[model samples]
Target: MTASPTLFTRIIAREIPSDIVYEDENYIAIRDIAPKAPVHLLVIPKNVSARLDEITDAEEMGRLWLTAVKVARQHAADYRLLINSGEKGGQVVFHTHIHILAGWENGPDSDT
Candidate 1:
């Protein structure tokens, strides 16, 4: 049988070392190692699920999305939320995650 992919799996397997900010039974919040903004962070669900569309149930989706928002607010007074889907959408990791970017104004020339 194929194995289910989880956000924590990569971290646990040491495939990637995230600047972890928070962790618990259900979720993990980590700083974006290659950040685009000053306060770029990623909030990931601990459970195994490949992508946002792969989420089989509604409750799980709610929990994951809400957790991302909560963690983002903790770091900045205000922030922008993002989630990349397929490869074309710029999702590098197979695991599902929400990116919380803030602490800098996104001007037209701001690429980072």
Candidate 2:
């Protein structure tokens, strides 16, 4: 883990305010500050991992996806789950997180 806390970590620590939708001991769900879809949420793990691929444990990976689904279902009937694996994969945060995109009327739009 980095010596300094990541943005998500600060939010989880309550050092930074966020629109948290759901939270548990190991995970947290929050609305994206800059939303792409009408209902854009982020499902993040409390434990720090630079990238999703960094987590190699089968159960841990499964639980992350499961928690993301739980959070998504709580907000929308249909949703898309996304994980940007690395900087080359379009991940900016450097923290492992799942993006929950949904709440579209006529499917997702480029501009929302």
Judge candidate 2 against the unseen true structure and give its global Cα lDDT, from 0 to 1: 0.93
Q: For each candidate in the order shown, give its overall lDDT on alpha carbons.
A: 0.81, 0.93
Q: What is candidate 1's lDDT per residue for 1-109, written digit by digit as tens?
A: 9786454687845587778887778988888888888898888887766778999899999998888888987898878889998899998888888999888766424
In model 1, state the lDDT of residue 40: 86
Q: Residue 1 of candidate 1: its Cα lDDT?
A: 100
TM-score attained by model 2:
0.94
Which runs of model 1 end up more than 4 angstroms from their true locations?
Answer: 4-8, 12-16, 105-112
Give a tens-digit lDDT track for model 2, residues 24-103: 99999999999989999999999989898889999999999999999999999989999998888999998899999998
Report the number of backbone clashes for model 2: 0
- In order, what is each prediction's RMSD in angstroms? 2.7, 1.6
